[model samples]
Target: MTRTILTEAGAQTAPSGDALWLSAADALRITGWELKPEGMCRGELCVPLPAGMAKDGQIDLAAFWGHIGAPLAHDAGGTVWSLGTAASERRQSLETLEAPDFTLPDLAGAAHSLSDLRGKKTLLVTWASW
Candidate 1:
């Protein structure tokens, strides 16, 4: 049976499997990463993966994601998913003492990215109701 998976790329349809096995096409559409002979390639970036991760033309999403030292979480029923930044990228940001970039909507619902304010002194005040 096929189910709707909620990922960072939004909802995607995938068949049931032991791993989050998705077709090469679906993998690229959902994750923007493609399994190439040189490993997973996204544009000029490619990360080498282990052998046999792709079987019958499908790749294991969870395995590929974890291999890059990123975080992924799912509900108990596996219907929802969340992807987080990779450790390597986070480490790089920490090394540079730069704040992580993120996007948020302004008062007029205009979306803005922290990177848009790059090279400017910006103060970020956040609030959350626990």
Candidate 2:
């Protein structure tokens, strides 16, 4: 869950406080991942970004967020970007995916498909609060 940070031509990280500001477009270009005025691009996929760029030429933060179904948070100073949550649920690649399967027990104490609990042991555990 690492994020890319963009800076001026060769900005340095501050030793005691927040880093210097990066215009959104510059940040995106350098990282090769950005929510730009045209859209969000990674490798080759482009989602039609729905808002205009800011007066200063950065992508409009709020509109880009809305387009991606992601949430935004800003510090007291209003420096903001998508919280990076939207794509958190996405798969980085299809390298490891197994089919879904499961099983459960019935009140009669008989195990059912959960597929009939085939090739597996069905444990019946119950709990109650009185």
Candidate 3:
């Protein structure tokens, strides 16, 4: 059986277990992290993984996710996981006091993005189902 891996970007199907054991390709597809001899790397950022973290040449998804300070949550069966942004990244975003850029249609059906008004005083009104 395979577990459903969910991230803000998208969802992926990965091997199921108490923890996910992923091949290098699967890791990249799901989390954009590459398991290398030196560490888990994404582009120029290389995070030195601890010894034995990649046993049998497979990356432990849960271990590496938590190791990088991201919060991971799964169901009782540990078959569905939701990976959140890393704490440091979240903190940095918060420090900026800026909402993430998004696009939406206006009354005239014109598409506009928050980023388009980066310098202007833009008021965003949002409502959600809680």
Candidate 4:
């Protein structure tokens, strides 16, 4: 599933199994934190950001954002930024509770239910091409 948060600045989209990147406006809109050419801010508080923001309005995101304290890096393209892994202090996985049963349609339009595998050990893994 895809999760998104719409803020006054813009829409921040974070797909499952993928990291999140927020523009200066996006970060301010969602978290009420503004990214100056210097770093992040919310009135008097200013965080000395990292070396992500070049001459342009881009940011390389410092190693602190919410509970996932990881930095966001930009490649040579400068178009796409990669949000690195959560801090070592975080859990290996963020899922802390079991989910409710849901059904998904197969390629052939057959419905598959999680409950169907109740008696077996089920491992669900996810990935993206990036």
lDDT of each: 0.79, 0.46, 0.83, 0.52
lDDT of 4 by residue, 1-130 (tens): 4435443234465332223444565556555667775557778867666554422543333334532365455445444344444455235343544544567777799989888988788887667789
What are the TM-scores, per candidate, against the unseen true structure?
Answer: 0.72, 0.39, 0.75, 0.34
- Tens digit of per-residue lDDT, candidate 3, span 1-130: 7999999766889875556777777889888888888899999989998876787768887888888989999888778889988878988988998788767778899988789887788777878789
Worst 10 residues of 4 by lDDT: 54-63
The numbered model that scores best in TM-score is 3
**By lDDT, who's the top model here?**
3
Cα lDDT tens digits for candidate 2, 16-116:
21222345555465434465455667667777754343445455544555566655554454332234435443443323443224455578887655554
Off by over 4 Å in 2: 1-24, 29-32, 35-38, 51-56, 80-82, 91-130
- Measured on C-alpha atoms, candidate 1 has an lDDT of 0.79
Q: Which stretches of candidate 3 lie over 4 Å from their true place?
A: 16-18, 96-99, 102-121
Decoy 2 TM-score against native: 0.39
Cα displacement (Å) at residue 104, model 1: 1.3
Residues 7-117, model 1: lDDT tens digits:
544677777766577888888887889988888899999998798777787988888888888898887776556666687877887999878777778889999999999
Selected candidate, larger TM-score, 2 vs 3:
3
Order by lDDT, highest first: 3, 1, 4, 2
User: What's the TM for model 3?
Assistant: 0.75
Error of 3 at 4 (Å): 0.2
